[model samples]
Target chain A: MEKIPVLKIGNLLLISIQTDIYDSQGLQLQDDIANLLQRHSFRGVILDISSLSIVDSFMGKIINNIASISLVMGAETVVSGMQPAVAITLVELGLEMPNVKTTLSLEKAIQFFNEKFNRETDQDGSSQE
Target chain B: MEVLKSKTLKISEEKDLLNIRGLIREYAGEIGLPEIYKVKLLTATSEIARNVLKYAVSGRMTIRILSDIYKGIEVICEDNGKGIADVDSAMKKGFSTSGSLGLGLPGAKSLVHVFHIDSKLSVGTRVRLIVWRK
Candidate 1:
């Protein structure tokens, strides 16, 4: 069996999940990713789901949970590279993850994060009550 | 009345993980399930199939389509393997006895209209799921 891979880039954590996203192994990967975010204090997480062929309601729930928990830990979560079919399946299953950002590509996701980070820093530098 | 039934799938070495999804789609379609319902059922069935192959060593699934005012598909997946010792806790979202993401049962339940599990420690585990067309 192939293992799901996780990588850290700057303050962003990228998790390359192997196996169908509906399976137990894939869900475990979600939990593991959440733990990593809490432990490392990453600023953001990018879940690269291009490899997944399927995403069921259960997997969606786990991903949603991860995104929510990450926010509590002060980390924003972004899901990128979702196959169109997987997105359709998730929508049909009524699986919606609130406050989770999505991007078409990793580069776009990184750019979005950079912009958000810069804006935050600028605001912090200028104290306006 | 016997509303719907399919030929028994032979348990064999030729069967791979992908085959399970195909079987599920065929049966689900036969039961008049919408395309969306078919996709969800396929995913849930695939998860259970993976469990069968990983833990049971070998097994087969029987799907029956129920007919009434409300049409639905019922899948009974049975395997002789190490039965789940703590089904209640296992049903929790993040609990996995195999250290897996533990989403198999929870995912399956979320996809179907009804979900039930029956198991004996040494005997086996039988998972039943019904997905109604909406």
Candidate 2:
């Protein structure tokens, strides 16, 4: 019954999945992210799966679903720090979660999001207030 | 098959799938299977285990170590649900009714050396996989 913690920083949400994810857990996370998006305004979500050693097609689908859901709600999702074996398995499994973007490291992910949001905020007619 | 060790696990819930993965990793590693093979076995088991949870809502998975003319590990997953109507089509990528990517059975079969699946209408499904030590 472990809950994956979601943290809010500025205009983004962060979730670090370090353990094996269950079906309920994955569903709960999708719901949590969606709920959080409603109560607050965010532009992006970053999922850190560096500590994860295994991932299957179901888990891959969940990630795909989350990214799509976030996209519909006006936020993009960025996944960082995937293990090599997992990447190989995901490719071999043929999961094409195109909406979910990937950055090799946390630092790069931060920079990527920072530049994206900063550009949004910089525009005079932007949605952000 | 000369058995070195074996254990049976239940895949009746969401959490059980994760535990089964951990158990498979431990047992497979204990048998000294290589890292890549370990990952393949783990991924293959995850696929079938998730299928059991999705299609049947519950099932049993047995892991056994074999040592005779061939040294390796074997995994069997059984479930009593609406049996796959057409395994040939089901095994094809992108063929799924449950909103999945339909990569479970096919992805699993490619990871191991020996694979077999048997099921009947309204009966159940039994998938067997064996990966020899190399």
Candidate 3:
């Protein structure tokens, strides 16, 4: 089975979906992300789907599941880079993935994670002091 | 209506789903559908195609380009499997027998300009989807 690569960078896993993934591939990605989060101490996941031109109900479901699983595994998940058309279709399809956080671009997602975790760490450090 | 071009493709495997989307995109471009409408058509086609794979195990799709009163694309998906029992309930949101989100049929219908479905208990199911150029 072909696997979508999950790259680790500074306490986060970055997955850039450069192609329209198959349904099984999406399921596999969810499993892979869960495994990575469980084994590694990753603080967040950034899923870049800007390259995906269409997001149907199944793909939307798979993404929602991934975000939920990542949350359970103690990692925040942000899906970024949705094309304008894709966003419109998602709404028309009524797949409001309320649980998943989204950003306009991968850069913003990374910044979001940095700020989030940094703030948490700051709080922890100050509490300790 | 005049038929410009027509093609048929088998939809059995997961890869076929991607193929169908690509084919729809190509045909929609050929017919001069707007990019956003193209995405809507592709997404709707995907939902129905995935249902065919999940329930019937396999199916076939026919893509036809039409001209005349409505310059549009029509897709007919047919599958020979245990058919849907209650289509009305099936169309309702958040209804699924296979533990899915049950959004495929309704979501697909919402995206396209025209939609139709037919099914029988011991026979099979067929769904017709169409999107027009605007």
Candidate 4:
């Protein structure tokens, strides 16, 4: 009933998926997030899924889709703050997250991205040397 | 002595999923799983049931209370639809032919204590998942 919230912090967009992240809702939400990523051309995205108690096939697919699309858009996606129980469930389900990054907290994720950004900038600056 | 089973259309319909969720919840309550655990079970069941309805045409799901001592629930979802050609690959996360996020089987497997799946090409698929409260 409650719509999933999407927030933008700097170049990164945070999509707070509030539901169980299973079945049709999960698919729909993934599509919405993908559209947002393509439309806005964000540099990074964090799927804050701490609210989801369980991760099902549909939800997993959405996460995978987002990660895959982010790469195409030149944006990196990170999934942060997944419940341990949910994580365990996902492993047992045999869901493999290939290119997506994962973090324990959003702050840490942002920091990780910031570091990458700085590193890339430093490399470019030194190229002239 | 609690059991529930349902026959439904292909895996895309949402109504069949709702019915399956209700049934799983009732059984979870009867088995006295903690509220948090019950919610997890409900979500897991819904995901798998939806897959059965969507991927396999005319599937049936059965949930039964295993025994009093163990306080466990076992669910079997069987469908004679197009079978999964690669069971191992299908079990992998983010591996979906349908362009979905591909978390359904993996997610359901994560929620319960024991999860097993079997599929034969053109023969359909069957999944058995078990959760214990004790």
Best by lDDT: 3
Candidate 3 CAPRI classification by DockQ: high
Off by over 4 Å in 4: A1-3, A121-129, B1-12, B15-47, B57-64, B76-128
If you assessed candidate 2 against the hidden native complex, which CAPRI class would it receive?
medium
**Candidate 2 accuracy as TM-score:** 0.91
Which regions of candidate 3 deviate over 4 angstroms? Answer: none
The positional error of residue B110 in candidate 4, measured at the CA in angstroms, is 8.5
* DockQ scores of the candidates: 0.16, 0.55, 0.89, 0.26
lDDT over C-alpha atoms for residue A102 of model 1: 94
Worst 10-residue stretch by lDDT in candidate 3 chain A? A90-99
lDDT tens digits, residue span B1-134, model 1: 34566544533332455566666667766666776677667777766776777677777787777776777777788888888888898777667766666667776677778889998898998998888876
lDDT of 3 by residue, A14-125 (tens): 9999988877888889889989898888988899998989888888988899889988888888999999999989888888887789999999999998889889999999
Say which candidate scores most in TM-score: 3
Kindly give the stretch of ten consecutive residues in candidate 3 chain B with the minimal lDDT sum: B17-26
TM-score of each: 0.58, 0.91, 0.97, 0.69
Best by DockQ: 3
B16-103: candidate 2 lDDT, tens digit per residue: 8777777778888787887777777888889988888888888899988988676798999988888889999888888888877889
lDDT tens per residue, model 4, B1-134: 44443333234466666566666677777768776566567657766777776677568777777774577778788888888898888777677888666777776776778889999988888888888887
Which scores higher on lDDT, 2 or 4? 2
Judge candidate 3 at residue A54 and give its lDDT.
Answer: 83
Model 3: pairs clashing at backbone N, Cα or C within 3 Å: none
Could you tell me which 10 consecutive residues in candidate 1 chain B have the lowest summed lDDT?
Answer: B6-15
